[model samples]
Target: MMMEIYKRTVVGEDGPTVVTESVPGLRSVSLGLWVRVGARDEVSEQQGISHFVEHAVFKGTTSRDAFDIANSLESLGGNLDAFTSRDVTCYHGRCLAEHLDIALAVLADLLQNPMFDPAELTKERRVILEEIQSVEDTPEDLIHDLFAQSVWGRDPVGAPILGTPDTVNAFTQDDLFEFTGRHYRPSNMIISAAGHLDHASVVEQVEKLFGSVPASPPARRAPSSAPRSYQHYYRDIGQTHLCLGTTSWSYIHPRQYDLLVANTVLGGGMTSRLFQEIREKRGLAYSVYSYVETLEDTGLFSTYMACDRCRLKDAVEVMWTQLLVLKECGITEVELASAKAQLKGELILGAESMSNRMSNLAYDEMYLQRYLSMDDTLKEIESVTLEGVYDACQTLHDEQGMHQVTVGP
Candidate 1:
């Protein structure tokens, strides 16, 4: 199966910007046309433009109207969707193996020939405005964005991937075209497909479809330089939303596997320390968990909980205590082994989904620039020693690295 995984970067004027991956044997296939631009790539005024473009691209393409675009794949028992993130935008979908070419053609058409109609842009602007308002109405979701803004400060990386109402309202049709032209280039794109598919044939299709779109070098934003810090916002809400986090390793960090174990032991699930201590033992909140976001150049370790305003102080104090305890004493041998096993099982289970495999393929090509066999990845996870977990815990929990954000009255 290891030898069955194939990845190669096509080279030429019409060559693919990055390599593609194919993992056979499944009855269906998943494909993603990844572009290297998102919220973080936009200037202050263009905050949500990347995400807007994601929606607009699907409104219609040269060959497919929005209705045809929506039904083209579904009529064949396939799916289609796209999303924008802080670092990248992905147009991805899944379908039965026999329907791979349909998925590929629709996706290629969307990326290469989006109509971006003025009427569609007008309708989407209102849709996005409602989306921004929905987030404002959901405290749990809004608080994380607030936490990010607080910690990352003025950096665009900290900005909400869904831009503010003002920015969303300001995007014009020309703005959409300008953004797409600047960033939607072969040089900044990675096309990945996984499951029952032919690698050479997929490559040929990509070259023929995308190669015609001339490549343009994007003027990307400079790397973020802001230091992590805290900001507390007062809102007259029933439950308080809070987060404590700090910077951690990037995607390529050597000790990230150890960090993964440390995070799991801390609060990766219901059985995690944060959940057990904060929710089960103390009854401080209905929801509590710790998570890490590992990006291309940076990462974040954050723990979030929503609890009664009265117990806010106590909840925060308990969280800090656990952090200090982990930093000082490290996780137990029992906990370390459990976390490792859980992580391994999750990786194996996740691989079963064609969508996940397709996503993994895009990420590896976009960030790692090489294909890593499933065995290779599992071995990396398996190699994290108990001592390594301790080191990771101590470093991420270093007192100076921590910060806090709380949102509620």
Candidate 2:
């Protein structure tokens, strides 16, 4: 059965707020405030400021202290959360449908009226420093950061999303305030809601809450990238973790869906070639997968695995061999059919959630500037062909375009 995904958008005086049509008799609603600014917007001097702002906003707002802010949501048996990434920072929550107005008001207040208390800033700075140290201690997670550094070099886009301890230590309240003023404008943000939402009611509430926020475009810059290279870091550890990667087109590219399917065939699922060949056949490693993350202007295609130090070389060899095989012989019809179906199934399953739907709305408004209907997305996934996926592999598998990062003793 083809399910219809109805979406409505209201361009209030503040900015655009989009609401996905509600599911009949759904239990919860997900509300999100998405700002199109993130770590990538920071310069070397301002690194980590965006992430700090993400944490700080939750600390308190003008009317609600951090405790009040938290209790307000929890009392309703709802959830509150926020995260900062390379390109965007989001504050999102889910609650009973009847409490949607309260959730919306709280999120709007946090965005427009954060207190940025000095004491809270100091506490968050210490917390972030500890976080940086924690990352240094976790090799499985650290390898991906190292891989990004290798691929992007010194570009801010390639820098760690959590920022360095030094950078975190250097940020000030003024810096955070300036960053917020610069990027947290109406024109640079989107409000998305899904699940059991009354579109007209939500729109009316959003206009009243946000109608006064000034709208302005953000200053933009491009990231600098270097050619792919091999980077090895020696650390005394029981297992070696590596991130093997290559460059690929950004989200707007025509071949993105093809790349998505190709990535799945390579190592995405437990039944994938990497999992089958590495674990089932050779018993090299317990964990292995390939993933593709496409941004507005760039993308990363990476395969990650962890294994005993003794098997590192063999594992790398096997992983590289899989890439080469896909480039030369391409995926078989069975693999092609399987990958497409898996991708489509996953897409459908995610549609069952209002949180995922709201997140999708934010992503579309921030990058694509046009809403992509779920039907369109499914069609695109189905439209991918074996030849298209093969060509995508051939284009991305170039030796000159591949980068490898290894961390272990």
Candidate 3:
């Protein structure tokens, strides 16, 4: 069966450009506004502005106060949320299909008309600082930050999405305004909605509401050369959290599918080698896994583990043993088959919701520059062989691919 994807582009008078897609359904609808700017686009001084701006947008808008904004969404039984990553920041809402218009309007207001109230800015700064503190409290999370710093070194990809307290506190209203205006251009924005709705009518409403922003050229930067290896911090926690990884493929790389399958058999699932060997058999760690993260230009394959401080060396050895085994022996046909089945199941189950479909569509356009059919994606996963998985594993196990960071007692 062929999946239908509907798309429309809205050109405005003076504001940002909007691109949207519709996935027909009767249940929930998700409206997502994706902006092009993120941490990678910022200079050292401007580090956390993208994430800070994400928070400030909800403080208030020109026409609605923060409470009013929250109340409006609540009244429609919708949930509003936003996240900033190294490559993009997205503001999204999920609601009943009938409430799509209200959700879209709220998203538009938050993105374009934020008030940046001075008092609210102060309040949010404290809120964000507390968020930073909260993350520091989680050793598992904190170690990844340290590991990212180790792998990417001083590059933007290595930077935390949450700005440090110094940068977050130093941000002024002018900084928020300047960053928002420059990065939130029509051409750099994507508005995607999926659920029960008429495609043409949805396009019309979006055009009426957002058709006034002018597209501006976004700031661009050259890519960083891949790092050989780097390490920075060693913090004291009861259980040591360590991440060992190196840069891999990007979203567009042909090897990504093979890597995904390989990761599944290696650590992406509960039955993965890392879990079976480390947690089930050896009892070295309650939490240990390997996964891959692909960015616009580069990617990372990492193994994360947290265990008793005394067991740190053993845990590292166990993880390294598994890597060596994977590189030399690779996966069996049965394992490859199991991994493919699991991967296919996840893809189908994930697509049952409009929100997932909408986000998937937008992500395809933004990263891959084109959407692969569900069948095509599934076929790609199915095509991954034992040898392919082994080759991918070997590449990752090479000396140039290894980087590690540890935080513990």
Backbone clashes for every candidate come to: 0, 0, 11
Model-by-model lDDT, in order?
0.83, 0.84, 0.80
Where does candidate 1 clash, by residue pair?
none
List ranges where model 2 is wrong by over 4 Å. 1-5, 212-215, 221-224
User: What lDDT would candidate 1 get against the real structure?
Assistant: 0.83
Weakest lDDT window of 10 consecutive positions for candidate 2: 1-10
Q: Could you give the C-alpha RMSD of every candidate to the true structure, in order shown?
A: 2.0, 1.6, 2.2
Query: Ten-residue segment with the worst summed lDDT in candidate 3?
Result: 16-25
Residue 242, candidate 2: alpha-carbon lDDT: 86
Cα error of candidate 1 at position 230, Å: 3.7
Among the numbered candidates, top TM-score falls to: 2
lDDT of 1 by residue, 95-132 (tens): 99888888888987898799989999999989999999
In terms of lDDT, model 2 sits at 0.84
Report the lDDT tens digits of candidate 3 across residue range 73-105.
Answer: 788788899999988999988898778888888
